[model samples]
Target chain A: DVKVTQSSRYLVKRTGEKVFLECVQDMDHENMFWYRQDPGLGLRLIYFSYDVKMKEKGDIPEGYSVSREKKERFSLILESASTNQTSMYLCASSFEGYEQYFGPGTRLTVT
Target chain B: QQPVQSPQAVILREGEDAVINCSSSKALYSVHWYRQKHGEAPIFLMILLKGGEQKGHDKISASFNEKKQQSSLYLTASQLSYSGTYFCGTGVMEYGNKLVFGAGTILRVKS
Candidate 1:
């Protein structure tokens, strides 16, 4: 079965701290994405990478950066975490225009 | 712009049926549906391509109207395990591989 895995199931950090969230997929998908979900806001795309070293900004990309150095791993980075950035972060991977397989998600809290 | 979803929340009793709708302002290349249980990642339920087709998995089915740029998910004879937040993600040519999501519809099932 295809699997997407996140580095942490939960995380807590201080405001202004730099944070990194890692995602790895065993499916070797060409497209990977990072999304932040909040109550009532649903899932908002932060960034997506189409290939190794190729990245695209989504609707809500501010304060966030992503890296896809390898085919199986994608990384989301918070330059300076803030309280408002606290939410559940989800990582997904898919082939081109197909359905996505998602990680279990990381619940992040910035206090 | 993000696609819009209707009926932000709904409740269903066992064996009841429910429909959730997602509409996009821009023309769509495809629509992806997912179900995210509380505190978990969104799981891929189905994908509707641009051919104006309908598909089903288990007791759930969905229709996509390419002309209307809309998709509706139908849940039949709902089960307790069906309780979760349903999200419809829209993929547009302008956005490339980025799948923009709706605000999501929350569904609760009771006995």
Candidate 2:
């Protein structure tokens, strides 16, 4: 079975604080992705990593960055947390060109 | 560009039928369907390639039309378990590495 785990189920951060959301996948997939989901807007990709230390921006990458220091872990960084950044963040992993398996998701609230 | 989904939201009774549509403005090589329950990860339902046939799960089925760059998901005899947000991911031939998703269609099934 494929297992993807996120570091936190809920998080609250103050304005301008730095926030990090971690994700780990046990399937050894080569692709990892970070997406933020909002009501009505659905899930929008933030960043994706194809290989360790390799990252690419997705449609809504502003104000967000990602890290993939190891194959099993991928992190999403919010350099300056703002109220507008509050949303449900999801981490997903998949084999090359295959279906993705997602983590439970981290709901971040910026105050 | 992100794909477009129709009937932004739908409410149905048990044993009812519904159809959710996803249309893409860009050429697509593949399309994926997923269902995400409240606060949980999205689960992969089916994937339809450019020339692949329709895919189904029990009473739920999906068809992809390469020429029209669209896909439709059919849910028959809807059950309570079918209530959730449905998203369709689109993959273009130009860039096979990423999948662009639609806004999502929310389905609410009542007893």
Candidate 3:
């Protein structure tokens, strides 16, 4: 079975604080993605990595960066968290652009 | 661009049936469906490619219309466990491997 795990289920951070959300997949997929889901907004892509050290910006990448130093791990970084950045963060991995397997999301609260 | 979903929300009884539609303005290479239960990660339902194939899992099924760039999900004899937010992610050929997801449709099933 494919397993995707996130570093946290919930997190709280003060404004202007740095935040990191980690994801790891055991399927050895080549594609990994970061998305933020908000009510009535669905899942909007923040960033994606196709290979180690290879990153691409999705539709909404502002104030966010991603790292893919290894194949199994992907990390999302918020340069300086703001209240508007509060959202449910989801990490997904796919093999060869197929159906994605998602991790339990991290609900971030930026106060 | 994000796909458009019809009927923002729906409510059904345990034995009732419902349909959710997703349409995109751009030409789509594939359509992926997911169900996200409350406080859980989204789970892959199915993927419909450009060939306009119909796929099913248990009592749930989906069809894609390549000509119209549309897809529809059908849930028959719905069960309480079927309650969730349904999202359709569209893959555009020009967009490479990324999928643009629609604002999801919320489904609630009552016994």
Candidate 4:
């Protein structure tokens, strides 16, 4: 079975702090994505990488950055955490434009 | 642009039926559907790729209309396990691998 594992299931950070959320998928999929989900907003794409070292900005990419140095791992970084950034972050991997398999998600709270 | 989903929320009893619609303003290569239970990552339910093609998994089914750039998910004889937030992700040529999701439709099932 394909498994997408996240570094943390829950996290708390202070305002202005730099935070990193990691996601690793065992399926070796070519595409990896970072999304933030909030109540009523659904899942908004933050960023995505189709290949190692290649990244593209999604609709809601501000205040965030992503890294995909290796084929199996993708990272989401918050340059300066703020209270408004608190939400459930999800990582997903897919075979380029196909259906995606997702991680368990990390619920982050910024204070 | 993000697709618009109708019936923001719905309630259904076991064995009932429901439909969730997703419409996009831009032409699409495909429309993907996913289900996210409370506090969890979204899971791939199905994908509609061709115009007028309908597919089903278990009791859940979906249809795509290429001309209208719309898709609809049909849940027939709904089961308790079908309760969750249903999301439609649109695939646009300009967006590449990014799947911009809709606002989502929340579904609640009662025994």
Tens digit of lDDT per residue, candidate 2, span A1-111? 999999999999999999999999998898999999998888889998999999999999999999999999999999999999999999999998678899999999999
Q: In candidate 1, residue A9 scores what lDDT?
A: 96
Q: Give the TM-score of candidate 2.
A: 0.96
lDDT of 3 by residue, B1-111 (tens): 899998899999999999999999998899999999999999999888887664436667888888899999999999999999999999998777789999999999999
Q: In model 1, where do residues sit more than 4 Å from their true spots?
A: B53-56
A-chain TM-score per prediction?
0.98, 0.98, 0.99, 0.98
On a 0 to 1 TM-score scale, where does candidate 1 land against the true structure?
Answer: 0.96
Q: Assess the local accuracy of residue A14 in candidate 4 as a C-alpha lDDT between 0 and 100.
A: 99
**Which residue pairs clash in candidate 4?**
none
Residue pair clashes in candidate 1? none
What is the C-alpha lDDT profile of model 1 across B5-106, one tens digit per residue? 988999999999999999989999989999999877788898888875544366789989989999999999999999999999999987887898988999
- The deviation in Å at residue B89 for candidate 1 is 0.4
Residue B103 C-alpha lDDT in model 1: 86
Candidate 3 chain A lDDT trough over 10 residues, lowest sum: A92-101
DockQ of each model vs. true complex: 0.87, 0.82, 0.86, 0.90
**Each candidate's TM vs. the true structure?**
0.96, 0.96, 0.97, 0.96
Of the true interface contacts, each candidate retains a share of: 0.90, 0.79, 0.82, 0.95
**Which candidate tops lDDT?**
3
B-chain TM-score for every candidate? 0.94, 0.94, 0.94, 0.92
**Which tens-of-lDDT digit does each residue in B1-111 have in candidate 2?**
989999899999999999999999999988889999987899998888888854445667898898999999999999999999999999898765689999999999999
* Model 3 regions lying over 4 Å from their true place: B53-56
